[model samples]
Target: MVDWLTVLASGLLSFIVSIASFEVRLRREQSVEESAEVEDWYTETAAHAAEVRRTWQRLWDSPEHPGSNLTEISSQMGLFERQISRHASSGEQLDVDPDVVDALDALAEECRKPSEHSFHSNSNSEFVEFRNDILDAVERVEEHLAEN
Candidate 1:
């Protein structure tokens, strides 16, 4: 009778340990998959932001005809703004750093302002300062995004 009881006890202990091990592995895999998904999202957002930054100054010179240049950059910037808005909302669930969202909002605000002569021969130092601020904000988003 004692031998049968010991066998039953050992079987139960082994089953519990196996289940605990499986649970740990399952949780770890879910974490890894979530991280990969987030990284893909970050890659897309970063690429779009970089493209906007690169083309920002070109809007003034981008027109063959008149008035088209004004619309071109504004349209692109609008798209960029919408992307940031969506990303910020999605990131809220992941507990993304607030700094990332704050910087994104700042970028969206700056972009929404009419492309006020992104650059011109007579543009003052203020233009340079504004451009630098935009760059810094973009970098800040990229930096904070990787932390999550």
Candidate 2:
């Protein structure tokens, strides 16, 4: 009464379905992990930018000579650059937007301006304008990241 061929075919079908389900679940988990990594990277980058801004402000506010903190600011900027580069090159495969890169580049240039004699010696109105430009550039980066 037992049909051997039918039993074998049914067993094969069950095994294939189980394998396919396992693969789908594995891919889904990998996707979630990648997404979380990207989110963390963005959050850290934004915070790093804010920290740079704060340190720059502190340098400007220092009672000591304006150039006193120049070395520290430069170091911080360099570290920030390295952090961005690391994420981009990491095997984790982050999807970086060109617009965000442009925005960050603009911000870095603005950051350097604060240490320049031209910007440092400028009138208060000019200083305010330059500061606003830096803020705008940072906002652009944040907006791009959120959109992506």
Candidate 3:
């Protein structure tokens, strides 16, 4: 009878051990799944950042066109602004730093202001210079976004 009791005890112990092992495996699998999810989020964020940089590059490349309609330019700028706002609102992390956003905002505000018409030859040159400056600011923001 004592031998039979000992055998029963051994079986019970083995059952407990098996249960614990199964639980450990389940926990490990859950952890791996969570890690994979985080990796996917990071990859998606990076892709969004790259897209923002590309848009900035396009804006900078063709800031001033002599023959371009003002309405078209204004529409494009508005679209870019909307895209930036949308991406920032999305779950993806911002590629550009907050400071860059502030700088760009200020530059954009300056560009939006109506220029005082002057007969002076330098007036057009001044406007061109201002546009160039805004483009430069956008480029800087783009570079910062791409680096991240």
Higher-ranked by lDDT: 1 or 3: 1
By summed lDDT, the worst window of 10 consecutive residues in model 3 runs over 110-119
Model 3: per-residue Cα lDDT at residue 7: 95
- What are the per-residue Cα lDDT tens digits for candidate 3 across 81-123? 5554454444234333465455445444533431222335454
List all candidate RMSDs to the true structure.
Answer: 5.2, 4.5, 7.9
Query: Candidate 2 vs candidate 3: which has greater lDDT?
Result: 2
* Winner by TM-score between candidate 3 and candidate 2: 2
TM-scores vs. true structure, each candidate: 0.67, 0.68, 0.43
| Clashing pairs in model 1, backbone N/Cα/C closer than 3 A | none
Instruction: Give candidate 1 misplaced runs (Cα > 4 Å).
Output: 61-68, 115-136, 139-148
User: Which of the numbered candidates is closest to the native, going by highest lDDT?
Assistant: 1
* Of candidates 3 and 1, the better by TM-score: 1
- Error at 122, model 3, angstroms: 21
RMSD of 2: 4.5
Better of 1 and 2 by TM-score: 2
Cα deviation at 15, candidate 2, in Å, is: 0.7
